[model samples]
Target: MLKKVRTVLDDVLDIERILGKISQDKANPRDIIGLNESLKCIPKLKELLHLEDIKKLNSAADSFADTAPVVELISEKLNEEVPAQLQQGHVFREGINKELDELRKLASGGKQWIAEMQESEREKTGISKLKVGFNKVFGYYLEISKIHQDKVPETYIRKQTLVNAERYITAELKEYEEKILSAEEDIMAIESELFAECCQKILDRADLIQINAKLLNRLDVLTTFAHLAIQKKYCKPALVSDAVLDIKDGRHPVVENLLPASDRFVGNDLKMNVDKSQIHLITGPNMAGKSTYLRQVGLIVLMAQVGCYVPAKKATIGMVDRLFTRVGASDNLAGGESTFLVEMIEAANILNNATAQSLILLDEIGRGTATFDGLSLAWAITEYLHNHKAVAARTLFATHYHELTELEHTLERLQNHHAAVKEFGDQIVFLKKIMPGPGDKSYGIHVARMAGLPGSIISRAKDILNHHLEESMDQSGTSISPEASKQLSMFEQQEAKFKKDLDEVDVDSMTPIQALQKLDELKKKHGL
Candidate 1:
């Protein structure tokens, strides 16, 4: 394979050669030369592919056709080097058209005669400041300074007057102008016709040219894959028929290359199957490699399917038909959509489209809305993926909602993982490693402190968090202290009695005065 690739690389011309030739108006001598050189290599490329060792190259080479006729035609007509503008002439080789050559000679001779006429007019008019100039609007003119305008002859017809000069055209000058301009136009017209003919000949064989170009493109891509594999020490992944993905020590391909030598990326293992661990619920504090882990798994699967080596010690990838990712959020304010609305829309797209053989990576799903709403949506999404009758797609869900970790106990196919971290008093060290089991705490306050939040804000946040936890525990009937549990129980009894009294009241049938009297009595009895 390497030998075959090297042979093609040596024979193929750069694609830029033919790209310029493809355009009708812009094709020039350089383009034709490039096309000719490229066409010369096609036959040689086909012969090289026929060699016994070149298996993959044979199929692509068979599709290429010989375009030597077009090459010969262009070579026979175009000059060695043509100017950028076709009107300037020399666009075609000598003898390609006799009339074009004669017109070119006439235009050249007229330019020399005009120069001599300028000198003769100055002498005859006796105006030392007189000069000749040409413009598109007025083909040619003789100019005299305002101070010397009185010296103008009656034979010079005034064409235009400027602030400080007078311009005129003589009979001799006008006749010369017609001849010169006509010859120049004729030369350009003929050259355009001839060049168009050359381009048409090339376009006639367009199919053959396109096929060869495609073969060269495939060869270039294969060579690039070979180079990247050698440089990055990538290994071929084992593709299996079963719906399972197991990678031992997989590294994020792009991230690992971008890190400095001293802070090399820490590789992690990913093992998931549709039957046992279809959904991986990852929990961790901010910036703890959860997003990176999810992305790397998706990328590795994609790379393997496209016939490229993966960045892992070993990998066995099951075939996945589709891949979906809902990774980030941003509001489209102009379209009247908030960040949360956008997040929901993307989530909806994934749930509606993903199949059992699809791989999904959802990072911080439902995070753009209120806490409970976001958590509920995230929880429900996980449930749907786990229990969907027909499609149980492989999913990697990363979220800060630690409440989701409870799903593992009830969900048969759900498993829990966390980005491991170690704490030293107020300081925390992110291990950047994925491990089994859910995280006990998100350490949001610690993460906030690391982000440089004010100490007062961090302290107050901790207090609020503690208060919330206590309230949650008390509500769940799991209070730690006896006194608190008794207080809550008493409050519940009073709440129940108040509801019972309200339920027994017959205020609708009573008169206004009686109703007021009953309300006062109930308020007094309840110690209102």
Candidate 2:
């Protein structure tokens, strides 16, 4: 059982690099129809093992990877598959069903038997109804009414000796009393044993039910794989196709459908032809389709490896031991780590452990840091993935820093890719298409403007940029001598004084009259 669980964990978890589609929620398949919903069968997978006719179904289970499609095709032809699966007390479901039935019958019989026994006691004692119940130092009992006292026989009276304040039973009544008391004991004993057995049976049946549930879950997984194959229009690949990941006509499944036809995706075709080679650097603009392309690759690999047909028109996949994704945002409030710190920890985990057969998808690897630090780290990580690590696992590294694109020239078996974009005057539109080569420009300011920034802010940003550009040029042409250092210090002192004077004005509290007085005072102080 543990081994089977381990197998499932490998396939179900770590979804970063498999393919471009989210796995359907396995536990609920009611909303899903056809083979896509087949995954729902996993909870009942264990049932296949316990049936008396499971011997006949062995062929179906053993050949599940291949000829199981025949079962689906046959079911489709006969139209009996669904009803058969839904029935309770299926040969496999009967063990649990029978146990539950037996328990219910035992409880019902126990109640009925007790009721009849009580009626017999009432008839024998001439006690038509239960009037009062009492427990004395001797035994439990039902008391008779004064009107029914005459119904007692002479033998009961003759044997009686006045032993109580009211009336007492003779030896004759004692014998009858023993009979009633014995009947109750007998009924109680039978009920105790019967109920204990029922409880035990129920517990056993519950265990069997749970086991059957797990088996059904496994069955659902198999069916899901078959359904995926049909949808992708591909045959299930042999286990030997273990080393191949071929995706033909692959589009980002989620994106392609949601986007308009005019803005629809251009598919990505990547065949990792080299063994021990897994890293491709992707450089593009802010709104370019790099992230989408990476996600597509990851989703595709995930689907294929899990034995499901991929979203691509055609694909033959390999087993990825682990798929690690360091994409998107994560908040780390409890850990007291910032967004960038969380990103770094995840990246570190991937870099430290990823192997040749592992799939790693990294998006904007170092974008959480300062410009130079982030770019440098991104560049180094790309180099490490390309040159140092086991390349057997595939990697898709996406970044906006174009300088890292230089790696394509430096590393063998390394390739450059980017998402395409179109420029419209000052407005650059993202095409959201993956293509070969790196992007040439960083449209950070352009994107910012498009997101709604005032014209005045844009102009101010441009002026600051120009001033910094000029300062850089001068710094590169000159040396920092002692005289220059002294001048810099004097400039800093004067700037400090100017800032102190500016801070002296309390703009928030100043009224209109105070503002006019301050303007005149400023004009006199500066001789304006």
Candidate 3:
């Protein structure tokens, strides 16, 4: 993903735009922040298609080493330098800090002399010992021992403590303790100041990183723009290919490098002669590389939009106002709409909004419906796209509807084309080649045989198709007008007749068995 973005960026900037600048070797907080901002807006860049994951991957990469470099450096410096001062002060402050440790020993009776004095004071006051604290002005003062003390010894008296009269300790001890504490405070203050300074340093470098990131993010887009300018530089508009994508060789960036030397792609040029007056209809059997051709065109347009080198040699791109795709269809099961409904909705949206500068690829656009309905809808959609919606946006509409070839002469921009195929006696072969003309037939029976269908079933299906096809050919010869409207009318008439019959039936008086009998009669009458 990173490599893809890098390629796109490289394509956009080109050699001249970059002026020999090298890619950044390291990532810092500034880079991370800029990436974050780019990611926030990438989802809204309609010009690029299906690049959400690419943007998200870069966003995650940006965060991988996004620590503030300055802060880390400062912290490292402070930790190394301040330890020496802390060690020196630890000795001077030891006596004051260890006072509790000494008191614990005295309580244990190891200091027999101090224990005797403590016992005497406890006997007079009914207490053993007390915890205490003090500061600079007041040395050390008793806490629990405060209320019990009567006359303290001079040695026990606090000569230094905080300015507030809260605790007490000896002046000699307080003086050294205060100096150690003050020094530690100064070190901490310096550490904090340095960290803040580091933050500022990172911010200072932000502009440069942000600029670099922007350049990288927009690299592909800019490259495409530049490439187009070069391609169309001084040529007359009509001199270019006729609304057709004519590349002598083309390769898929994501797949080209994976092929072995012997199997390496000799890029294939695509010639889609779609113009203000031409819509090429692509018809072929499944898995014959029809989808790959469609994707190649779509990817090319997207690359051009983003300013990158399209996967073609000597490419000439036409302007596309918007690109709409109704390629893959699925269901909105959560919304209770079936797969067919979802497919229709997307197809409707594309037909409603597409403009002449738009590029559209519709793969099996109406396949989710009944055979005749699907073929009719596909034909109408092709006609609409060719004659109306996008007279200029080159389209590659692939479908299984071979009958739609009749529109080739009727519609100005409508042309019939198909993926090439080979037939061996009764066997069929998918050549995966784009050629000029329509497929004479779909090898459904041949495909079934290839899929290991029983020979007996294949023979029976062939017989059934041959019988029906013979009758159809006799009825209308090679040209069969669409049967979709007739089927719809038939359904409407049936529904009306059923409703009329249903109005005469008295359901309220019928028993369970009677109702069942009545339903059976209705089914028989309608051939349900």
**Angstrom error at residue 444, model 3:** 2.4
Error of 1 at 513 (Å): 78
Error at 229, model 1, angstroms: 1.5
How do all models score by TM-score? 0.79, 0.51, 0.51
Candidate 1 lDDT trough over 10 residues, lowest sum: 15-24
- Over 415-516, each residue of candidate 3 has an lDDT whose tens digit, in order, gives 777877898876677776777888888777877777767655776787799778867876876734447424557778998677556545656568999989
C-alpha RMSD values across all candidates: 13.8, 14.3, 17.4
Model 3: number of backbone collisions: 28
RMSD of 3: 17.4
The digit string of per-residue lDDT tens for model 2 on 453-516 reads 7655655675687577667767787645546645657557766555444445555568999978
Better of 1 and 3 by lDDT: 1
Candidates sorted by lDDT, best first: 1, 3, 2
C-alpha lDDT score of every prediction, in listed order: 0.84, 0.57, 0.57
Best by TM-score: 1
Residue 366: error of model 1 in Å? 2.1
Residue pair clashes in candidate 1: none
